[model samples]
Target: MRRRIHAFSAVLALLFVAVFWISTVVSELFLSAAAVAQVKLAIAYALLGFVPVMMLTGASGFALGGKGRHPLLLAKRRRMSFIVANGLFVLAPAAVFLSIRAQAGSFDSVFYSVQALELAAGAANLGLIGLNIRDGIRLGRRRI
Candidate 1:
């Protein structure tokens, strides 16, 4: 049952990513510049917000117990993977879009700063999640 739930969650996450990427690509090809820019902004915002939501679901799953390893460990693994994947898959492209959207003008410096911040934030989250994975693996092994 826990595996099923986890699989379901993964499927949903993948679907969301797929839809966002496809929509963005199609919109970029067909939409007006202003519309594309708006879509990019929305995607950036949505990616930022998705991290905490997945974390919550993972934490709740652990608390409720599951069929995987120690529930806590399983949850940690899921959360870490989710964060790392999100940072890589969503945040990177979003940052690139933001930089491109900056228009390479007087505001270019500010745009670069914003893009740097976004990458930094994503990297920080990824780093923390990596640490959690290391610790979780250590603890999980101790139980074995």
Candidate 2:
């Protein structure tokens, strides 16, 4: 059951990350005001889902770690920590700021810059999480 839950949470995390990345790309590529508004709304709604999914991901990851000293496990934990920190400290705030600017009908250069930074940070998170997932699968296979 725990293994199933862990797998489920990991999948959820990956799904949300992919959605966040694709949405950012779509919003950037097509800069119509209506498109921007719709994308911003989608992103805002995604955040509502992202937060809880990430929480579950973190909780299950820690539970699975189980105080082990395996190198892959340690690496996974470190990567997860970085991803979580990036999301909370950087990505979330940028998204909120962008959403507010969009809501207020402000689409200045600053907004674009923020969006770019958010996308870059998100890409980094995606890569790191992908590595962690690979490490997780290896750990599971080894039963360690």
Candidate 3:
């Protein structure tokens, strides 16, 4: 079961990378409206892809080494880190892209930014779900 989850996580990671790669190429190579829309969709999909991957990782973590630690405390730390990293990575980049796209007077840029925002939001949601899972696991193992 753990191996299956790991394999699923690996595939998800690859898919996420491919989406980003395609988005990058499209954004870098073609500055047209259609290409921008495509990139936006790709970014949105990438964010959606994170949900299952996060679950798999969180499950893998609990299954492997969360045996004796305080689950709430560990989950808190993990969630904080995820939030910080998501802000640094997804939110920051989305803001920059939106600003640039706005300055260029492209309507598609607005949509693109919207999609990036969705990605950031999705990541945050995934983080929270992970926290919930961790808490549930901890509760399940409690003596009380």
Top candidate on TM-score is 2
The order by descending TM-score is 2, 3, 1
Task: Choose the strongest candidate by lDDT.
Answer: 2
TM-score list, all predictions? 0.45, 0.94, 0.45
Q: Where in model 2 is the C-alpha error above 4 Å?
A: none
* Candidate 1 ranges with C-alpha deviation above 4 Å: 56-144
Tens-place lDDT per residue, model 3, 49-116, is 56567556556645654454665746644664665466447654664464456445566656455655
Model 1 C-alpha RMSD to native: 8.0
Superior candidate under lDDT, 2 versus 3: 2
**What pairs collide in candidate 1?**
none
Clashing pairs in 2: none
Tens-digit lDDT track of model 2 for 1-144: 777788888888888878877977877687777678677777777888889988988888888788999999999988988998999998888888888888788889999899889889989998998898889889999998
Number of backbone-clashing residue pairs for each candidate, in the order shown? 0, 0, 0
lDDT of 2: 0.85
RMSD values, in order shown: 8.0, 1.2, 8.8
Which wins on TM-score, candidate 1 or candidate 2? 2
